[model samples]
Target: MSTFDDLDAFVATRRQAGLALSPDGARLVTTVAELAPDGTKPVTSLWEVDPTGEAPARRLTRSAAGESAAAFAPDGDLLFTSRRPDPTVEAGDDEPAALWVLPRHGGEARQILAPGDGITSFEVARDAGHVVVTTTVPVGPAPEPPEGTQDTDEAPDAAAALRAARKKAGVSARLHDRFPVRFWDHDLGPGRPQIRVHDQLAADRLTEPVAVVDPAGPTERVRESAISPDGTRLAVAVDVRDPGGASGATGDRGDPAAVRVRLELRPTGGGETEVVADEAGADHEMPVVTPDGRWLLWIREEHAAPGRAPAQSLQARELAGGGTRTVVEAGRWAIRSVTGAADPDVVLVVADEQGHAPVFRVSVADGSVTRLTASGAYGDVVASPEGGAVYAMRATMDAPPVPVRLDPHTADQEPAVLRGATEIDDVPGTLTEVHATAEDGTPLRAWLALPAGASERSPAPLLLWVHGGPYMSWNAWSWRWCPWLMVAQGYAVLLPDPRLSTGYGRGFTDPATGAWGGLPYTDLMTVTDAALERPDLDASRTAAMGGSFGGYMANWIAGHTDRFDAIVTHASIWHLDGFVGTTDGSYHWVRQWGDPITDRDRYDEHSPHRFAAAITTPMLVIHGDKDYRVPIGEGLRLWYDLQRHGVESQFLYFPDENHWVLKPGDAKLWYRTVFAFLAHHVLGEKWERPALV
Candidate 1:
């Protein structure tokens, strides 16, 4: 075995994902996921990063169940939600997560509050320490009466208990009247989401809770809510059903079935609700109030029609009961992770641009933008109240998410690494950026990583890796699609950002959804042609790979061109019409592809299945049965097509996996089989059977 061929090393890699900062900015916290003691499940734990890059990183919480959703309380306390067993109280096997607090002064972390169900998300007021939490409560019919049983004082409680028992006994079934019967990966109905606002008088106690946005029943759910900076009001995003009334996410009978999200404001202490900001054909979400509570900022995503590109704008409103709307950042560069930096008039926005996701400072006064930290994809910026220090989690194609400190106002400054518990082993490759131009003369950019010692004399074979999302940019490190593994075996992988990719301004991306088959496919080939132009890349021995939307593109590329020696498509789509109906969220595709029957022309023209008979290159298809987004049927059909046509193809099936092959064993096999397939096709070597089937 090669020195880097051990699967254990791949499984042992610690993953760091999210970041948070203390109110004073003295401490930076990040969530790190690693294998548990038994190496069975990945446990998420909070790690304290030295914001100033001085102190050694420390693990803040350690428990068997793990902790997540870290947030800072007003009085310098750290609050997180956990399902860890509390020794002070009896716990059940199916324990609902409860709120726990770790005092800033340092002491034992203890449970502060518990919800009837469990807390999904929460926001805390900076001044009053008020908390707003969202939870779900399934609505069930009252238990059937016991054959004309008489009403008693405990009848309601008895029936509720019986309903719970029935659910536990697998007798409960759900019937939905809503259009969105299913969401991403799960069914949506049978329960309604509630946003509750309440004040925590002291540790381990609460005064009372007020239903800021109460629901009539299970259908009217509340979402995207935040506690005001002063704890005096609440801002939330609620679904505004289409006036046409008969549509939603079910995509039933080819109806529009679209719903838009709007912003609403109500008193935190429970009072009148007002429409804070609502734009027609737009959804307003991710509301955040300024530290002074003078301005409220949120994201407004304008729904795009077929043959058009969707747009996102940073919308703002005056919270002083006045009426004025402002576009802080207008649909440019895919602004993300928007937060009020140390300067209230400016916000720290992480945007995808070129080949990186950099932090940008956007001025609220003039709409001018300035780039902050130089190179890397930044996430969740946190700044000191004094406007002096800023910390962000930076990632790149080569490095995983790592906390770093940078000047908030610096136009270009190197980020000082804030040491954390998670770190990567030495990368065995060289990373560089390349550029290309599409058939329409539009420029494209991608990150290309080549193995060590790869050069003109010993050119490395290429792997054209298409990113999923067809909208998301390839700016950050992805464990699922890590090129280092392929590079470790002497291959160069190209990560390109096609037209539908973000980080570019609206002009480059907004129109991309409508032209996916045209520009996205063209731009990908353009980048591939550019990469092959390099002296160190082998053009004839290249291959293409992708998952999800990338898988769709791979399928398309297979039918359109045999430029690559082979292709590997995972969690892919084979039939557009079938995908629109069977996918967990059918409404999403209709927005971009239109109704299949009503708009059959577009589907027929763009769907890859129509041209599958033209595929000549060998292919490898990978899929998970539990993948609801791209159903297993897509993979099954593609496999059958390849076999029926007598094409040299292999199918790697995963029954217990999802959209992603997440298990340690499964992940290892994924890399092993992919490399083996590439070795046989790209290098003209004998196919090596993987350790597992």
Candidate 2:
């Protein structure tokens, strides 16, 4: 078949796989994001399809810049995060990101907050009277040292200088400028944002707004805060650096240099503080309180789990007794978030195991784990108040994500497909489950998507799509739509749940311990080799791609091997040496790399940038300008190094994007660039290259 025909066929295959049902299980939301006339951009939108076997879906949110995080408010109103127009603010500031409230049936959306600044998250309070939002507020300036103090002066002078500096800097005096003060409260009205009842700190108190909980040292400011369901207590996730460490050089891994997480609780009316849990070396995140306010559920990672690695287990603690218990023991795969179900006794957990995230239910009393859904990987599960049904997005290796519903009690766990992806047409393809033996002979599970109309004798080009969480797993369902787009282009996609991936238990994911590059890389290579042995995959035209930790792997693979024709690394860490000093999570990186100061050689050897000269394949580096996780500077460093070494390289930088592109239009553009790059290098297609320099 001609390349264009192959592309068309691939798109058709993806179309079939892109079908997704909506949260309520009554409508379908298609994957509509596709490359616009500008081959480097995609078209993303929210479409509604009737699941009652009716006509095609109707488009819901149609905009050049798409919408995300759509949910039904307590009163059945639709609340979604969008970057629509905000005439109140002038252009050139951050894009207007506000929570838009609309009717479930659909209509014009009213912007709740005047757009212009960044609104990281919003939740409709149980009463629906107010909306809880977490946002970034600018701090004025750094504090000056005490008037009479000098660096070489007496001890009293030094203390005075520090206090003066702290006073002038406000709460964020010591942190990097990018680390702004994060304020959380209720949206009392259209124009006013008030601090929540539980979050109010008495004025003039020495405690500041909130406490920082990083491992390296204390954050001069508060980073994140969440409220309990009863609205009586607030759980604040603080990132405090260790104060006893060396100042300039990267902190040691075991030395407790990174931000250590602590769970602190205070009454809604403002009372004395209580420390619920604190691990000297580990970080606790995504804290959620039970409906009865009896237990607190959160994800915690032992400081021992290296950079960007998954947590050891999900833990729960009783507020009264102060005892902790393991809720879910799938190690290495991080639990993203947990929500109290309609039934107060059961809680729904959304976790990524081996890159494949799914929802599971656990009994608060007995601690029994029940698999609520089937093999398809899913995410962002919104449980009904009744606890009988769950709303989530499901995807597989070859399918675009479809909204689905899971009924936990019955055998009818198969997700009812809600809508088909509208952007790309689906091509015919066969999805298969395979297991490859790792270098240590451990079986690694993977999902393989092959081009349709292929036989044992016919092999198509392969695209190895790795997941970001080195701790996550590749599930059976459709969670990402990008892989389907490539599959539609006649490329066989292989998603492996490698060692250190969740779902396989702690032993498998523990490979990340003290060895970041060794076992995980071996597992990936083993899986790739096994896929090549399949009759339907073309071994000669293989490509590699991933984001975050996956991006790190892509860079690592590109530099370590020449087996793949092309590579794309998104929001990935390149230079471990630079990362030690630059990124916000440098201390965490050091811990993962086993104390870079003590293991400097190992850190340098594992870093992708260290071996940049060996990357001969055409590479595409994609990163968001404001990405704080794997900062954009890392990508730039790799892009410049590749160019300097006379390698074919291109960098696509999204100006208003973060670690992951959230805007619909930005997401579409990102996927378009990815496919176009892959098509050009992997399929030898005639595609235009956007100027990167």
The local lDDT score (0 to 100) that residue 20 gets in candidate 2 is 32
Best by lDDT: 1
Clashes of 1: 3
lDDT of 1 by residue, 83-147 (tens): 98767889977777888888899999988777757788888888888888887766666666556
lDDT of 2 by residue, 456-490 (tens): 67778988888876656666443233455566577
By summed lDDT, the worst window of 10 consecutive residues in model 2 runs over: 183-192
Residue 44, model 1: lDDT of 86
Candidate 2 Cα errors over 4 Å, as ranges: 1-119, 127-131, 141-230, 243-257, 292-294, 305-310, 317-322, 330-333, 353-356, 419-424, 476-481, 565-572, 609-628, 636-693
Residue 482's lDDT within candidate 2 is 48
lDDT of 1 at 439: 76
